[model samples]
Target: MSTLLSLNAQSRDADHMLEQALQQWGGERDLWIFGYGSLIWRPDFDFSERCSAHVHGWHRALKMWSTINRGTPQCPGLVFGMLSGGSCQGMVFRIPRDYGEAVMRKLWLREMPNAVYDPRWLPCKTLQGPVQALAFTLSRQSPHHTGELEPDEYRRIFSQARGIYGTTLDYAQATFDELQRLGIADKALQRLLSYADCDRSVESVAI
Candidate 1:
């Protein structure tokens, strides 16, 4: 159908654009990528080194609505969005200079399919020093971006939403667990996990 063809065309165009971004952002040395969410647990790429880094002015929150990976149109599940304020502690991935372009392109394909994130080579503070790392932060202007959501809305989505990737609870729980392992505590995620626990219990009784 025309829609399918359009999607394919968009993918191709995105690939081409990201290929260009790689060249521009990679710089003369190794490239660093900052990850705070799924990237922390599943960075499916080969990185030369990983460092615990911190970035100010952005904190991860469940502010993005997913219609595919974690939810559907009727009950969109929530996902992390790096919002402006506070600081975040997460892992930074370093890609070899020669492999920068290829890795950037792959990352773009994975994260930018929906164009919901604002990708930039941001400067992060790491123990080694400072590095300009590629980061995907939420864009407030995007339709998928929800600057804020009610507590009950989160409970509803985590309980009812399921997508191709898995259950919303699973996604939230995994992220919370990974953060704990990394010595980073996310209070908001912890609350979501508790809500998910309640949801599972309620489902159990119904079944």
Candidate 2:
């Protein structure tokens, strides 16, 4: 996989921020990181192995709304949230302490570039036991946020928008495919495909 870099000034300064975080960790060899979304299938870093894990107090939801990719500015598409008081089943990868700085920098560049996320140390429940891991949560209070949308409005936005990568349908398909590959599924996301009002043949988002 390719390292994530900002294409413009508006992007979040991910590389710098991640380096700072790694420096704080001071190169702990036992460092492990968990990924649930795009990173689950597309991690660019070198890792020895990964296994199923779960994090409590957060659940992935399409909480972040964006018209930039899936809708117009007037109507944005939804993205994930590690909201409070829920649990998510995902995978965690262990990074060698020596490569911490580089791997952390790349991860921050990819996911935290927009400064829309707050990386918090959370406990990841692995087969061995609970391990401390840094998990990025979308800032619900950010001024740039579009707030939560009604399900109907969300459907409308998904039915429209085009992103930097491609159309909203493309976003949906990519997410669906990746999630299934991980053997994980969300009922909310599945429900979305059935409720969204778009031409499936042309503009449909996969379930």
Residue 133 lDDT, candidate 2, scale 0-100 = 71
Q: After superposition, how far is residue 89 of candidate 2 from its true place, in Å?
A: 1.3
What's the true lDDT of residue 45 in model 2?
87
Clashing pairs in 2: 12-113, 66-76, 66-77, 67-76, 69-162, 69-163, 70-161, 71-161
How much lDDT does candidate 1 score?
0.77
Which candidate achieves the best lDDT against the true structure?
1
Candidate 2's displacement at residue 104, Å, is: 1.0
lDDT by residue (1-207, candidate 2, tens digit) is: 111222256335665556545655678566777776666766888997788788877877666755454555665566565666678877888887877767887777666656777666677888888777767776557654556666666666666666665665566556667777777787767776655534464454454
- Pairs with backbone N, CA or C atoms under 3 Å apart (clashes), candidate 1: none
The superposed Cα distance between candidate 1 and the true structure at residue 18, in angstroms, equals 1.8
**Residue 112, candidate 2: how far off, in angstroms?**
2.1
Candidate 1 Cα misplacement greater than 4 A, ranges:
1-20, 200-207
